[model samples]
Target: MSDNLARQFLLREDVVFLNHGSFGACPRPVFEAYQGWQLELEREPVEFLGRRLHDLLRAPREALAAELGCGSEDIVGVLNATTGLNIVARSLDLKPGDQILTTDHEYSALEKTWAYVCRKTGAEIVVVKVPMPLTSEAAFTDAIIAGMTERTRVLFLSHITSPTALLFPIENAIAEARRRGIWSVIDGAHTPGHIKLDLEGIGADFYSGNCHKWMMTPKGSAFLHARPEVQGLLDPLVISHGWTAESKAPGAKGAFGNSPFIDEIEIQGTRDPAPWLTVPAAIQFRKDNDWWGVAAHCHALAQDTARQLGELTGLAPLSSPEFCAPQMVAMPIPECDPLVVHTTLFERYGIEIPVFRWQDRCIARLSVQGYNSRPQMDRLIDALSELLELGAPQIAAQG
Candidate 1:
């Protein structure tokens, strides 16, 4: 809300950054905490990794679980949301006639991941096209529910869409999946810090979120949560010590002596657990500064900017304000080369935002964080007004 908050982040002062949805900017205090963990790891690699690693991760995992409204056993830290979802996608037992139903608004990488899994397992991917200029939550839920069939095995959906920047009301969909005895996998990469999340209330079988994106943790800090009943169905992406322990003896268990899910996923060979360990610090940073207040301020700025952009281009917004993200909005830009528009905004105006083609239309998405102010929005609006003239003749005449 304050320009002073911008100085606490590691972002550069010379450029206007409106792409926090892609990769988030971490604050100075959180980064210092991350580095401290790394330093501790380096000082005693064997003692840290071999001895105290489990104990070290316990507190942060508990803290994150408390924040997410889930049990400590339900979640384990991972690199990112994609990695967490990959574990679920790769572990499913898909038959030739089985189908995975999802919307077209999913992230591109996960789209490829599902495609590859289906190709290998002989499963079908039923992609439902969610109508643009979204009317209401009931309509969106109905669109997804229509894609279900007798053979539909899994229902996948994003909590907040990557390109469209729309927040799908997934509670009804997840409840429907439960009623139909289907596995519900939620990709919540953009939800954790941007909006309120209650994993227990949502009741999704599997959910993955990125702390690095919205929670302001260092890169590679993310989490995967699975219901206790479904935990046994998932196999770790990498077969590690936990897997070996289970394989050697039918009833053999790891140090946890409880569920094998956390042990298997959390103890993937010795790498830096520092990123995962700093999650509490990131959560604390948000609490230290009233994050809900910051989110409200950023949402107002984003909505105002999108409204101005739509007025300038004479194009309506993709989704209603209630359905959009708190800090991010996708504005429909005039007909133009998306690549040229993206490059010119960065190279010429020092404004960093994403302008790309989503299906047949070009959209410029703006992301406003706690550090962003009204001046940054005005700068983007001015730069866009000048550059968009190249695509629209009327704008040039007005200028």
Candidate 2:
């Protein structure tokens, strides 16, 4: 992609940073914009968040909704996708013995959310294992659909997986869920700026994504989009004024549940909404810099990086090129201590990347951004070759 752009990220100067999927690298300009919003919030918290809050949020929400292809009312800013998913998982009146079906590719935090919801209600978590070397989108959809049953009340899938970095054809699965009246809750953590999303077109009951990941905003910026009909199904994690019969929305006096319009969870006492407010600045930054083209270029580089790394390491990829995300790729590494390698790369070679163990594998996930360049990838390749092949010998001898 654009090596110079990637260079703008404030990392240890010597490090060849590749792990954008974990938290995202904010461009210098976007970060400055973020700080500006933070300053604005600090300037007059009451005027910014209390009185003129909705008005300030409205324009940004409209802009984001237009980009995501949904109505502005359908979207609500949140801390992150984890909180967003919790709002949906806890809000929905999942019955005893109800099942929440999800793929093996989900982020661990959300998996815990599903487990928590299951523990509260007598619900079952049906985690479908998607085999590696993914052939096509149909193979994935078919496996997930095959797992569905009468008790399957929910279909929870990731837009782009955390560990595997593959894009699941969740729309097709959701279409089938609609036929069976199953609630679809999509965790789109890696998809906001990485891939094109049409929340309305996907027809998921509830979908949440992070701007801090792919959109390159300050951390703690994310959004949840819920269909109006099912919006009432959400119960904000915190109980507040919206819980009382008198305080309920116009629909019912005894509603006593999630107020979609005024999410009480949002009023969680007090915190910084600076990152959330920076949504417009982040989006505008992308607009000012031809983001779609940046995405396409990043995608190509990700594929290239995956191939180079896979060839160098002699490891089988988690998924085919067609199924994987353009921004990030996960290639399996030797089942060694992930921390050792992660630290080794950073401390020794100055390569900033995520090396973590997941599903009995150590995945090296590299995030391609506009700032990354061919030389950076080459540096990664050379350093990893040294770490895995040449360096392994010496490290073992020392022991």
Candidate 3:
């Protein structure tokens, strides 16, 4: 399975690819599906784009909707999760005293987006720290809930954090937000395929996730899910014909519908919709290959890597194995120039991975997919052991 799956991907054979969490490596089948859609669009631009685009997207969207546990109308395709979150952040009716509460473990790009929005509106961003070596789920929830105040207009959080790679207990946060009548916006970029998502069950006002990452879809495919109640609160990031469509009729049901949230956001002009049209194929790929079994195997590899690294470094993992992502784990590395180790591993060993400093600690994250093998995990473990032996000084010189 490992050898065959590895061959199915377009990733180079020479480099050991361990960074699937960053941007997913598409399988040959899915890539072909993406290209087929593109070819169909090019064959008859007018009929494909003008006549068939909306209908062509329906099946894929419905397939993803079932996986996400939402109705077809609740979800809309976007370029990526960041763009979906941007649409939510920018559309919010924030005022001077309003606050967007989140944790320190969020992706930096979304943090910057909120910062930009705050700069425009006089809102405040309160980032609470969910400390390393996390103690318990209650403690994690308490830390975020403690920051909530009367002015807390929104609760923004990551379902699976970026740098820390911890699967946060967001159900508590979502429940609390509902009780307080505050909006809950969840960034679930790493959650869609990595973890089972029940959007209707979770009940977040706005949810965004990326299919291009863990789902192994072609890049530029993602979704934004808005509950029917709050759909009007969001406007499209790129305003187009959907905005003006309502003028033709009383409520303006454009090509898609009068539901401004899905219609406005989904009908962006002159963009390639090929990646989105291939979602069902990616979903089919997962089912055909038994992705849950693959995820379990990959998870064992991640935990093994973390345990081996922890034994070598004498440092504890950021969270327990239970709280860590099944296929992605973040472990603390011994104090060194993170970039030096990152460079040494890639140049000397032909290993592709990410090592960086988050806050004051140096951390390396490992992402294991179906194609990864035990030997590949050992190669990273062995390379790190060799690199850290020389310390950052020798590693820096070699770099």
Global lDDT of model 2: 0.81
For candidate 2, lDDT tens digit of each residue in 59-91?
657778988999987888888999898888988
Candidate 3 global lDDT: 0.88
Any runs in candidate 3 off by more than 4 Å, and if so which? 245-252, 396-399
Best by lDDT: 1
lDDT of 3 at 376: 94
lDDT of 3 by residue, 193-302 (tens): 99988999999999999999999999999999999888877778787755654533434455565366666777888899999999999999999999998898899889
Q: Which residue runs does candidate 1 get wrong by more than 4 Å?
A: 245-252, 255-258, 391-399
What 10-residue stretch in candidate 3 is worst by lDDT? Answer: 245-254
Q: RMSD in angstroms, candidate 1?
A: 2.6
Write candidate 1's Cα lDDT for 167-201 as tens digits. Answer: 99999999999999999999999988899899999
Q: TM-score of every model? A: 0.96, 0.92, 0.96
